[model samples]
Target: MGEQQNPFRTGGIARGHRFADREREVARIGQGLREAGGKLLVYGPRRMGKTSAIARALDLEQARGGTVARADLSTLSSLADMADVVLREVTRAVAAGKGFDDFLAEILKRVNIGFSVKQDASTGVPIPQVDVSMRSKPLEEQKLAVGEVFDAIDGMAAEHGIVIGLVLDEFQEIHRFEENFSEWNLRHIIEQHENVGYVLAGSKRSLIDRMLEADGAFYRMFDKLTVGPIAEDYLVPWMEERLAPLGDGAGEASERIVALAGERTHDRMRLARHTWFRAQQAGRSGRGAVDHAFAGLVEEDADEFLRQWVHLTVPQQNVLRAVSMKVKGLSTADTLQRFALKNSPTAVQAAQVLVERELLFQRPGEKGYFFDNPYFEAWVRERTAIDLGMEPPE
Candidate 1:
């Protein structure tokens, strides 16, 4: 039963001995928190363990007597909704800490909510009834609510010396519904607030980049931190340590598993967990190391990974396929021509979208783009049966 949870966590933080790498990132975040209330923006391609890293960081913060609150902004529709959620969670978290009830009460007073304290007539024991409302409001109301939430945060900070760290996951999604509503206001509040720290993380690179760069409203408001793929050196040692308890051939098997994952941090950890589960299912045989057979299992399940890729537009699909075929390298012009795209502007637009989605990543100091994840690249190669070693025309 214990062996069952070893492989592949599709959602949430990796638990047990499954978490690998990011020691340096954790330390850096902790140090930044200790410094003059810092804001960290963790941007990476999807499924790269951005959330897991934040979760792990929060755990470390708690161990050191710090307060951390996380809010998933994906489900939130407007600025008001976001503000309410953040305030509610932050208030609850502050209330949980010893001697922090007063601080929590101060924040709660600014927000509109029904709170009932029922006392038994005879026993005098009280029951707390907290009825929270979730409703979308007008833009003006949203702005006020957001401002009040920030004010409450400021008030709490003034009373309690401890700094507050708020992590908003999928922050890019705020633009989808809010219509340039929250970004500028958030920037203003963050700029004004002293003891409040923020970590805005998102899977959408283009949105995040536009918010930080370009003449967009949030320009230069955040300290950029690109959470790249996890280091291989850290992954290798961590995997060996995780598998050591299994048996004699476990260390070698772990290496083979990591190799199969192709060094993309999240994929490597996910694949390692999957391989471990497969090995255990095969009776935890100490003699048989994780090898091509386990690799084949991952390959067989490739469709599961490609589901998101399959949803791309036809033009995006064609461009991605063309890039995959030209594995060696292809000039931007040649790639467009290879895909038989007549509209040069449209092709460029499609390519840019693909890059933003992280379906493609630019090869540093190189001309052409490459698939962000090797597994996806391999899947594309196998599906197309194309050799990408040939260089494009000069």
Candidate 2:
């Protein structure tokens, strides 16, 4: 097998052998997409592979004779942009498996917006291209254009017997597009559609919670699903198997990689990929190799870490240092003195700010906060070890 490349995929969507766990989640999403009028809200912390799982589910739905479309809301600037994405992707998905002439006859007639057909470069198939002129319109006009796009799709789905699934990844970004009315307006438009299953995926838990609050526009509109870490039992062995193709000591090294990388899927895979590279250089996948690889990563990101560090206040830096060191009772007299925090109130305020900046996060119903990036935590410990009179992390 032409020298297997790095099996640990850290970039883009993890697919094929690179993807691990989340079988149940994928199945649930596929089932939701297959049914008519299914609404689901899938969310998780950043880098948790929620997007990857959703993509896999969409692929499966498409294979099972369902029309599926996915668009990342984070990439768009306005509702009109979103409407264009939906119009292009939905039409592409619907027309992909059907006869070109049939799609033009059935779908094009229902769509009221102006668009043109562009031929695919490789497949030679025709692709629907939305008119860019819509972008120049007023925000209100753009909103109506978006609503019209969805209205047309809903009409098409009802007229033709078809199961359609629409996935809006990073759906919470709509708040930035039209803060005052976008949420309720979208909810209203979606409620009228009876044939398209909708899956809204997001990473920011704070904004998602606000949207689902009692007084919020999207309250109880979706069935909630939160993706968490893959089980270590599955992950470690999977990592070991992936690493085994590279060199020796895969078992122990995979364990260390997962432990050091913490629970996030992308983070773990990124470290694992680097660890594989280290193994290639050192001729073995061992604990020492993993540690060396991690230190290299810390060093590589040192400048960016320093930039983030310099932006915080002194007390915020101290609180971060404390959190990095895993110090308990951060506000206790001894802990504050050890970390050089000003006072209990000061430390509390600083930590809150760190959480707001996403430099730190506390698990739900959990007492203490944690570094969102474990590698950054390592950098902090290494940089402050001498002053703090502690040994640098290995």
Candidate 3:
């Protein structure tokens, strides 16, 4: 098959993954790693494309001959898996020309994927690709010696004069480790090297921020780079190019697409892809196409959303209903009466659970709240009126 006649895409990491408009950030990461040998933190909520941006930035440095490896610690079920994965990724990237088997004994673990030698046909130099996938074995399932994992990576960076980038995606999950390997220990290894740079990113904004606080282990250590949603201008034009062939309905379809997605990078792309697919299949465009696309997303998520709703307690569902409807004065008596919630305390408790589960989040630096998953919130309002016994809005 030739190049895409279709440009809408929204699956996977930053490169091929619904990627757009982080030129300034990409440049910042590259410059920090290159000039300052910076310990940088690229963090944001989920699906904001931190992984892709970091991967792209590291690729740029690699183009300039930097040896960079991205180890997604998120893929591991047990904390023990992380140390081994990182050691393997770093060693494989700087392996010079050796294969995964060469270091299997050294790392004392085996992964399904191979990191064997490959030579560039043109330059004859090795370009190590990230071999690990998201598959995880339980902690009780496997264990490995982590003692030399960090040290081996750091030594390789120093020994090879290679600039190594440790892009630890989902850095907050380190707290979930069974053995309680604290962040301070990781910070210690990171601090020892000038040649190695680290990009720590995660979705839980509050938790990740705690890791970087003044009294924290990584205090004053990293240059904080916030990765937020892509600008509207950047997203719209790229979307238009893909939707252009759809004709008269394309403009409305595109506008509806972005409007529903609400500055979320993944949602914008996924919705556009859905809209395009819907329009193509129906041989039509415009409001109908957009609505069908919207319906399709809600429908695809119906079971999951229902499961989520069922799992919530009565108060949580009520509070979620209020939040979904964009209720004002959340803590006030009127709000309590309007939602038939027990009281302000009940509302507060329910909201906290929703936030922890990432159903809702406070708008960054704002007092107002917003749904982390907007489609699910919309679904709640559409599907729950009769079930919840709430009268339909006027």
- Best-performing candidate as measured by lDDT: 2
Ranking by TM-score: 2, 3, 1
Model 2 regions lying over 4 Å from their true place: 98-108, 392-394
Cα RMSD (Å) per model?
5.5, 2.1, 5.5
Query: lDDT tens digits, residues 1-394, model 1?
Result: 3634453454567744566667766666665554445777888777777777788887777667777778788897666567766765565556444426565446457655444455435544333333334244456666666677766776676567777777878877767655546576677767777777778888766677678876875676677766777766666666766556555566666667666565466666666666566566664523244554445654876887578667888777766777757634343566656666556676667778878777787644677677777666666656543444443321
Provide the global lDDT of candidate 3 against the true structure.
0.69
Instruction: State the lDDT at 66 in candidate 3.
Output: 68
> What lDDT score belongs to each candidate, Candidate 1 first?
0.65, 0.83, 0.69
TM-score on alpha carbons, each prediction = 0.78, 0.94, 0.83
Global fold similarity of model 3 (TM-score)? 0.83
For candidate 3, lDDT tens digit of each residue in 1-394?
A: 2233446666776464445779998997777666425688877788777877887887787777666677777866665567556765665565543223244344334332233444556555443332333125444333323434655555555555556666777777777763645577667656776766777777878776777898887788888889888877777776776677765577777777878776577777778888877666665657778877887898899999999899999888888778777777678787788778888888898888888888888875677567887678778888874565776452
**Model 1: colliding residue pairs:** 7-273, 327-388, 328-388
Better of 1 and 2 by TM-score: 2
Residue 86 lDDT (model 2): 86
Which one is best on TM-score?
Answer: 2
- Model 3, position 195: C-alpha lDDT score: 67
Residue-wise lDDT of candidate 2 within 1-394, one digit each (tens)?
2455888887799988888989999998887776688888898999999999998998777776678889888888777788888877786778654412355455577666677788877667566766788777778887887888888777787778776788988988888876534678889989878888888899888888888899977798878888999999999999898888667789999999989998899889988999988887777998888998888889999999999989889899889888888877789998798888888999999999999898899899988889999889998888965677876544
Residue 13's lDDT within candidate 1 is: 78
